[model samples]
Target: MCVAHASGAPPSASTKAKSRPCPESPTPSSLRPMTRPAPPRSGSWTARPPCAAVLRSSATTQCKNLGPCTSGCAQGAKSSTDITYWPVALRAGVELRTRCRVREITVNADGMADGVWYYDEDGEEHHQRAEVVVLACNGVGTPRILLNSTSPEFPDSLANSSGLVGKNLMFHPVGFVQGLFEDRLDSHMGPQGCCMLSNEFYETDPERDFVRGYMMQIVRGGVWPWSTAMLGARSGTIPWGPGHHEAFARRFDHTANIGILCEDLPEEHNTVTLDPELVDSDGIPAPKITYTLSENSRAMLEHGVARAKEAMLAAGAIEVTGGGPARQAGWHLLGTARMGDDPETSVVNSWGRSHDVKNLFIVDGSIFVTSGGVNPTSTIQALALYIADTMKKNLANLFD
Candidate 1:
């Protein structure tokens, strides 16, 4: 994996000209050893830059690249919001509350959000009142909270007059294609995923069977010994009595993956609802997800898989194997409570303010109108910042 310097300096013009060709680009034969390339500013495709958290430098804290990034970074180098933003918020006098599970957003007699009802760590119920309420929960959680907050003023739920709060749940349906190389690539040395990105098929192509396209993310495949052995056993690649060691050796450290992130269109049938029979430890209703891939998404995924196989073969892969709509790839949750201009169509307005409850604001993925074919973290942050700025500018008439 390539590492970027912590100085945050742009590469020189000469370096830019020498950047590696994207694996899925027209010149797939030009694929070379992974090098530190300047991140693309704006383009259909480019080599993915090293994540800011993984940059190594004496001047800054960095990731040790110990590999299980999903389980929390022990080196504190993963720039999670809790490590990067919470401290600043704390310094700014933001009270950091933990171990409190919010159950519902309590509403006033006039149908305004007052605060929330929550269960503390000790399982004690508490109502924290506030003049204005904000919901930062993700697509599923936000709708669950709102749907549970029923009152006579808005008996259906808080800010749910449009009846679209838990409707239209969307997810980025991903497909995985793994290529086995002949030589060791040390592919698992750094961040587990995101070595390169290709958007060659990102836009809607009228000639294609799918309406929207997918983003191809070239990723490193980790060869954790135990996991590798388990996988090989399940796939019948490694035998139990004989040749197990030989098979494991051949399979390890020589694999790469291309992830296909398909754009999911909002569908009213794909929804989030409060489970009538299920509840958490505190007896709060749990969120029940109802989702299925649209035909367009399925077509897009099939096309993406075919293209991924072509790219792998072009890049000199000895073998490539994988398939679409990975059941466990519903990571990008969005569009449960979408934003729009009309109250009859969306739960929130353009500024993330609830259409029904003037004082209630949502700064999360739930307000997204569409699920773009990419990770939504940066966009979520940008939306939050924009909503914050809008609130600041309209403080005088914020709740009007």
Candidate 2:
């Protein structure tokens, strides 16, 4: 993997030498570690590599650093699949359907997935048939579709013989530590997050309270004037009325933040189920998620937050305020339909093919056996490519 600076400028000459085109086929050694340059800030930091698809190529555009990346990139340089892959797929004769919501996967008389039943924007339901069906929905949506695909042959649900369709839902439990800096850092000028990352505590140590560990990412603090005021008021740092403007000025661009991505282990109890009373506009049952941070996760968050505070203080932060197991930080959904060797213990096989329904393939986070300490997007994409290649190589025996 190549680590690029978060400044969003073209990579330096040294950085370009270390960078290479990512492999077309996934391999065990596909992500070899490469050395990174020193971070721009004062505290000790490690440059985190951007997404796997973000190779510095002539065809690719550099980031404009407009910030607010989470809200969608305005510059079209984010390299989302829609921007990077859809054009090629469209040229390859792939049909691009729009404004259609898949309701369920339909099975054939031979107990194989045939296609999907979806609803269009007009609230009209239709069935699209196929020789094989591939599901690329994320963890939640994948399991919800499978669980709702009940039939006479597979009375419980299609590819759900293991009875683990919606079980073991996992999320990246996160914590945040914001440091108040005395000087204006202009921290929000570049990519919102992904400024720098530290994996100093990523591996598990028996001495620590947690079995697994977490990653600390240096994030640019929010700098918008209105957002600053709202955050300050919510945290009681800036009160309403007389001194609000003064407090806002003090915090507008003078803060730094570190976000912790805790590795959440699989627990069968954390799950996604269909809500009995809730439904979408087409009357399809909606998915309801149930999750709680495990004791191990809470411990990891506590440790990560403490370490982040120390880093901030060492970097000359005036005040360090931190908390753990953030309620709203369940961003990466994974492990609901996990893969394994045993048919009774897993929903899919190592190749991402459903054990019970050979014609059904899953290419998403749902097939993750374990949720790692970092983001899963790159790994998910690699798995999709791997699965596609496997299907191509074994076309004759694909469903056997």
Please report the candidate that would top TM-score against the real structure.
Answer: 2
List model 1 lDDT by residue over 281-380, tens digit each.
Answer: 9998899999888999999999999888877776677888888888778777799889999999998999999999999999999998888887776578
TM-score, each model?
Answer: 0.85, 0.86
lDDT of 2 by residue, 54-86 (tens): 534444555655555666565666667766687
- Candidate 1 yields a Cα-based lDDT of 0.75
Task: List runs of model 2 lying over 4 Å from the truth.
Answer: 1-44, 51-59
Cα lDDT, all candidates:
0.75, 0.75
